[model samples]
Target: MLIAQLSDPHLRPKGVLYHGIVDSNAMFAAAIEHLNGLSPQPDLVLVSGDIVDEGAPAEYEFARELLSAIRQPLLVIPGNHDEREAFRRSFADFDTTSRSGPLHFAAGDFGPVRILGVDVTVPGLHHGDFDDDAAAWLEQQLAAAPGRPTIVMMHQPPFACGIPYVDEYWCRNGERLAALIARFPNVERIACGHVHRFMQLRFGGTLLCTAPSTTTAIALRFQADAEPASYLEPPAFLLHHWKEDAGLVTHLVPIGRFPGPFDFA
Candidate 1:
């Protein structure tokens, strides 16, 4: 099975640029085209979070139109920038899990993989949390399918990625999250967003991967006093290919029309 993960597009109204600089909507379109161009196309696509710049109805409306072009099955969770009710209404057709509550999180089987998306977005705040109720829910889901190769999807990464500014708003009570995931040996990885660049860390007895954005990357800074900023870097996404024998391997795929892929002479 193959899965493509695209994160943090931060879409605005049709003609508006993200943060009045990056053309995130157009880049997201390019990402859709890039996925279509893959040789062996992804069986599923996962949008980790932050579907729009601000939690606006118009943004979600435009987002719906844009996401309509994807060729594969898709699953999504809310990010700090996303509004839960609006997001729910936007994806109402695809997800009929409930009419109320936190972003309709649930587990579903897609061929060889069972994917469970956990919603931990903290309302009116940039940070998130793995509350006791959420932990209980996740534990129940993982326990039900112990042997299946599973992937846990969430917006905020459960571990610090060394970028002090971004780390300030990381998932709170992450230790509890790690402890829960450690008990589930079948978890292939913890797929996350929030951080705009590709970041990976060992956590919860498995690998944790944060997908790069379809727009700008949050500037990388190790200094504690560095101000938070973004860069118009090459937009990218992640591709996870899984096989019965090979386990799960993730590849970083850069978007846009780059230079030629010349063969070695």
Candidate 2:
């Protein structure tokens, strides 16, 4: 199965700009065009979160209009920038999207891989949570499919990414969640997106990767007091391909029209 992952489009209302600078909607449109241009195409597209800049209804409305261009199926979760009620109302027609409460869901019909999405956003906060209830719910889902190869998707990364500014709002109480995941050997990957950068880390007896945003790349800084900022670095996304013989491999693809593919004899 081939899966394409897109994160943090950060869409704004029509004729508006992201952070009053970048043309986020147009950038998102380019991402959609990029996805549609993939060879063999993807069996499914998984959106990690932050589909809009604000939790506003208008933002979701614009998000919906932009998202309609994806030819493949999609499963989306919410990020800190997404408002729950507005998100639910906007994407109510999607599969397994929670109609109320936290937007947690599990689906097994997408292909050989089973997808489990855990929403950790705390109503109005910049961080995420993995409390006992959330862990229990995850445990239940994992227990029900112990033999299935699974990909766990969430908005906030459970571990710190060394970027002090971004780490300030990471998922809280993540150790408990990690402990539980350690026992689930069928889990192939823990995919997350929130920091708007490409990163990979070892965690929970599996690989956890955070995809780059389809819009802006967050400034990469490790200094304790590094100023927070985002750049117009080339946009990027992730693709995870899985097969029975080769396990799973994830690729980072930068979105743009670069140079040519010369023949290498």
Q: Which candidate has the highest TM-score of all?
A: 2
Model 1 is weakest, by summed lDDT over 10 consecutive residues, at 95-104
lDDT of 1 by residue, 1-265 (tens): 8999999999999999987888899999999999999989999899999999898999999998999999888899999999888888888887633477776365565679888898889888989899987898889989888999999999998778889999999999899999999999899989999999998889988999999999999999999898999888999999999999999999999998887888975
Question: lDDT per residue, candidate 2, 72-141, as tens digits?
Answer: 8889999999998889888888779776789999988979999999999998899999987789899999
Model 1: how far is 260 from its true place, Å?
A: 2.3
The C-alpha TM-scores of every prediction are 0.97, 0.98
Q: Candidate 2, 144: how far from true, in Å?
A: 0.5
Residue-level error in angstroms, candidate 1, position 63: 0.3
**What's model 2's overall lDDT?**
0.92
After TM-score superposition, what is the CA distance of residue 145 in candidate 2 from its true location, in Å?
0.7
The candidate that wins on lDDT is 2
RMSD of each: 1.2, 0.9
Error of 2 at 141 (Å): 0.4
